[model samples]
Target chain A: GAGVSQTPSNKVTEKGKYVELRCDPISGHTALYWYRQSLGQGPEFLIYFQGTGAADDSGLPNDRFFAVRPEGSVSTLKIQRTERGDSAVYLCASSLIGTSGQETQYFGPGTRLLVL
Target chain B: AQSVTQLDSQVPVFEEAPVELRCNYSSSVSVYLFWYVQYPNQGLQLLLKYLSGSTLVKSINGFEAEFNKSQTSFHLRKPSVHISDTAEYFCAVKSRVGGKLQFGAGTQVVVTP
Candidate 1:
């Protein structure tokens, strides 16, 4: 009965460095999603996984933002050449694939990434 | 594409007072509405949702929201708020097919004694 969990509750890194944020979804969830929340702003969509494959990734800001879910259970969000503009809280959520896609999503505590 | 608009950016209310946070959404197709709350230093938690069957949905904590299809609005309300209710509340919407969530800027609710 564990909820979604993320690693490195806070991360501080220099500009141009690469960072990888990890997320572990619920036990039997088949759907995973990633979002980014900037200061004073709402969370924006990044990518989504519908199993081991990437289903919708249009929300990814640029080529530097990439995510993967190899075993359909755990996911990793990779950011290359982190910039000061990339500083924000990265959120992960998972849910069961509902028949009407109306399932409630459970969110993780999130990892706050600070680029200096 | 879907978008959510929270009319109030911040609201200050006294404990035991009634509170209401208005939320309006725009979408081409049918969507599901939700209310999420975030306490300081905590992650987002699902407060309530209106998917189907009921125009009014209530959470266990005495918060309730009514879905108005004609107005494209889902506003959250509480008869009497507690100091513990002070937090940031967000309004989000997603397509019925369920791909991603589009969130509003959020409303900060401050409850004082």
Candidate 2:
């Protein structure tokens, strides 16, 4: 079966530009998550969605970051006015129909974004 | 609030040598623990997890972790590491019922031939 996958493996944009990262979760998985990983650092949580609703989004750093999963299968993370600080690898993960703390999340290859 | 700490930023070991990655966490309530590995230019893969039952948990790749509640630690260990074991390891924790995870800075494991 296909695992979680992301589009545009690499994205390079200038500061103040807008960018969107896409994620396709595994089939039948109801939970989706987004995380960001900087150099020499572990992944930091960004947002989480259960079904069509966002179950938790406190991890989003600021108002410039937003994500949505309208159809409940694919998700998109939109960043407005990108900054150099946003340069990092964006990861997406998905899990079966279970509570967050107890479920195992499978990750995607990630999209490396560079904001100059 | 919950947070995880990986004490060792990097661990270098020769092939066939033993290795240990220390992890500690702080949380106001009981939580779930997880270990994830990431090769260069790749995504994270689940190594093991400690939800309940026994304090010691093992993965299929001859790696094991012992969850010590009293110490607030979940250290991962491998008796003998292979060259293929070189990767970045992350420690994560979340509240028993929460959806968001708090991750440590991560540890880089380098296996030498």
Candidate 3:
């Protein structure tokens, strides 16, 4: 009955530092996704995982941005050399099955990352 | 590739008044349409979606969205709104089955008494 949850509701870090954002999907969910939302902009896709393997990761901005989902239940988004441009709200979502695009994605409260 | 555009950035309406939020999408392939709502300090919630069959879809609440293929638009409307309806609404599209979503800039609805 629990929904997707993210850790560290807010994070503040300096440029060139590293940060990790965690996401715990709903129980029994087989698919997970990450997105980023900048001020005055809509959420942009980042990465997706189907089970323990990443099904789609084309949305990842660069090699500095990586994500891992071990055991197919929890996911972590890691950012290396954080930049002010990476400052945004990191969102996580999950669905029962990702085979159909019709599945509704349940979102988390998101983690607000600020780079100073 | 797919793209979505929300016509208005903000809409202010009086309580119990009609309200409409316009959304348009562009894609080379057929896509699934969806509307998501986000209340302050809350996560994004699904309002409604248009996958197939019916061109129109309604949410549990008093919200409805009509999908138009010709116009490539999925506009959400509500005949009457409550102050509780104040929130941000987003229009999104998925070009492929189980693929990533393309979201439009959200529309902030401010309901006033």
Candidate 4:
């Protein structure tokens, strides 16, 4: 793809439900990231992947939030036992791996999740 | 650990007026700084970055930012802003090696006619 792509631009789920959000990074980009943005706030890092492995997951918030990139190209973010507080936009970004400086991160349109 | 702070949550300015958005960060190691803009219903777009060299950096869109190492600040400024420039701006920082970004809360700029 020419740019990072996220599926299901919006999602609405009831409390305690499970939801999955998908992201497809640009081709040949080995670094992928996930972020969550609440109303009136900046995007908060959730996870980062280098190739098929998770380089960092410390920012996942809790056990209910999980993400995986099995092939290093497509990633999925799963939230279990969703709470109303989980309502936010989930963003995905990709960058070329091993870029010494702060490489530009190409972001997707983002998935707006509304936990009712 | 790294964190970014955007002092203003919202800023209002008339079209063609000068505007400045303040950002600061705290980090133990040397860091790279960036500013991103998000228009309505659009993904984030990079505005400018400060990796090394001169303290000042300019974007193609008439926006500029100065990185002050002593104060740990990277403030964005525009001499003349357009109504089309109204959007949400975010300040982010990351370790030179680690690609993960830590972002400020964000500042919403509203350009009134």
Candidate 5:
């Protein structure tokens, strides 16, 4: 009955620092996704995971951004050398099915990251 | 590449008035369309989606969207809205069956009583 959950609702870090955002998907969900949303803008795709491996990571902006879902249930988005432009809300989503794309994605509360 | 466009950046309306949010998308391949709503300081929630079959799709909360391939648009409409309906609405498109979704800028609906 629990929905997707994220940790550290808000995070503030200095530029050039690193941060990790965690996401816990709903039980029995195999597909997980991460998105970034700037102020007053819609969310943009970041990465996707189907089980243990990333099905498609083309959405990732650069090599500094990476994600891991070792157990296939929880995922962590890693940002290296954070910049002011990286300041945004990081959202996580999960669905019962993923490969088919028909399943509806359930979103998390999101973690607001601020780089100063 | 797939992209979405929300025609209106903001839509203000009085309570009990009809409202419509326009959306258009561009993609070389067939795509799935969806509308999501986000309340202040909250995450996005599914409002409605157009996958296949009937072109018209409705949500449980008095919201509906129609898929138009010719126009490459999927507009959201609510005949009569309540003040509580104020929020940001987004139009998104998925080019592949299980691929990344491209989202529009979003429309902020401000409902006045």
Candidate 6:
């Protein structure tokens, strides 16, 4: 009965460095999503995974933002050449797949990345 | 693309006072509405949702939200707030067929005595 969990609650890195944020979805969840939350703003969608393959990556800001869920369970968000602008909290969520796609998603305590 | 707007950034209320948080969303078609609450240093937790059928939904923790199609709003309310209710509340919307969500700038509710 564990919920979604993210690694490295806080990460500080220099600009132009690469970072990888990991997410472990709830057991038996096949749908995963990634979002970014900036100060004084709402969370913005980044990508979605359905059964191991990337279903929607349009929300990803650029090629530098990539995510993978190789086995349809755990996921990792990879950021290349991280910029100061990329400083924000990365959130991960998971939900059960449904015919209507209205299932409730459980969120993880985001990972706050600071690019100095 | 779906979008959500939370009008109030913060709401301060005395303990045992009624409180309301306003939320409005924009979408071309019918969508799913949800309310999530986040405590300090915690992830968001589901408060309530309005998917279909009844436009009114309530959470176990004495919180409720009414979905209004005409206004495209889903405002959260509670008859009497407690100190434990202090947290950031978010409004989210997504297409009925898509799982991606669009969240609003959260509303911070501070319950004071």
Single out the weakest 10-residue window by summed lDDT for candidate 1 chain B: B93-102
Q: Write the per-residue lDDT of candidate 2 for residues A1-116, one digit (tens) a residue.
A: 99999988999999999999999999999999999999888889999999999999988999999999999999999999999999999999999867446988899999999999
> What's model 5's lDDT at A45?
94
Query: Where is the poorest 10-residue window by lDDT in model 3 chain B?
Result: B93-102
TM-score of chain A of each: 0.98, 0.97, 0.97, 0.96, 0.97, 0.98
Error of 4 at B74 (Å): 0.5
CAPRI accuracy category, model 5: medium
Per-residue lDDT tens digits of candidate 3, residues A69-114? 9889999999999999999999999987755667778999999999
lDDT tens readout by residue for model 2, B18-49? 99999999999999899999987778999999
Model 3 lDDT, residue A38, Cα: 95
Q: TM-score of the candidate numbered 4?
A: 0.97
State the lDDT of candidate 6 residue by residue for A3-116, as single tens digits.
999998999999999999999999999999999999978889999999899989999999999999989999999999999999999999999987887889999999999999
TM-score of 1: 0.98
> What lDDT would each prediction earn against the true structure?
0.95, 0.94, 0.94, 0.94, 0.92, 0.94
Q: Give me the runs in candidate 4 sitting further than 4 Å from their true place.
A: none
Candidate with better lDDT, 4 vs 5: 4
Score candidate 5 by lDDT.
0.92
Highest lDDT: give the candidate number: 1
Give the Å error, residue B64, model 4.
0.4
Point to the candidate with the largest DockQ.
6
Give the 10-residue window scoring lowest on summed lDDT in candidate 1 chain A.
Answer: A96-105
What value does the lDDT take at residue B33 in candidate 6?
A: 92
Better of 1 and 6 by DockQ: 6
lDDT of 3 by residue, B2-113 (tens): 8999999999999999999999999999899999999988989999999999998999999999999999999999999999999999999987565678899999999999
Q: Between candidates 1 and 3, which one is better according to DockQ?
A: 1
